[model samples]
Target: MKKTSIETYYELFYRWQRSGLSKAAFADREGISKVSFYAWCKKFETKPDSQDASTGFTRIELAESASQSAVAKISYPSGISVEL
Candidate 1:
């Protein structure tokens, strides 16, 4: 077994994601064990939080509400004089 580093695990994970390869296929191509691939995913994968839905966002759905525009436009009288 080879000594694994945090850098190595992250590198493999990112490569797999970028390649769009299946976990098993990536592990096989990388000359790593299947268990290692799963382990790396467990350690590096972004965990989904159910609580996000309560805040109007969900981990399963990566979206946030756009900023609301509620302020009304300002109107000034022509009699007003201002110096810049």
Candidate 2:
């Protein structure tokens, strides 16, 4: 793998997360190895959103999907730029 700076990693992380590209697909596209991608995914899997109970997505699926959504995207606080 090519050496990447912190900024690049974070940018890659943010992009990979927000792009909704599954780990394998994103890793391939970004020239990142699957192991690294999975590592990042596991490391940052804490963004699950709370879902409405009435959505009928099933409790388990809702939880899983919420967790996946959280992992697949991220929101930064105002004034913070991924370019930094």
Candidate 3:
């Protein structure tokens, strides 16, 4: 087996997500162990310092509404919208 750098692993992670393949299948195609791939993903995802805008997740805070008629909305990048 050959050694892979963290940067390469990160790139593989990104590509795997875009490929829409299962983790096991992607790892097999990439010549890596699925277990290691999953471990790496968990490590990166849970690393406090790794939180950033690029993770495709954001922390949102909503203010408390005094009235029950308040409306809330969510907008997606694909032009989809949801209201509550």
Candidate 1's displacement at residue 78, Å, is 54
Candidate 3 — which residues are off by over 4 angstroms? 47-84
Residues 1-84 of candidate 2 have per-residue lDDT tens digits of 566554555567778878988878988998777897676566445434342222423233223553434332333667554421
TM-score to true structure, per model: 0.52, 0.44, 0.52
Per-residue accuracy of model 1 over 8-72 as CA lDDT, tens digit each:
77778878989988999999999988997898788666545352322444343323447553333
Error (Å) of candidate 1 at residue 74 is 36
Clashing pairs in 3: none
- RMSD of candidate 2 to true structure, Å: 16.2
For candidate 2, what is the TM-score?
A: 0.44
10 residues in a row with least lDDT, candidate 3: 47-56
User: In model 1, which regions exceed 4 Å deviation?
Assistant: 47-84
How many steric clashes does model 1 contain? 0
Cα displacement (Å) at residue 5, model 2: 3.2
Model 3 lDDT, residue 51, Cα: 49
TM-score-better candidate, 2 vs 3: 3
Clashes of each: 0, 1, 0
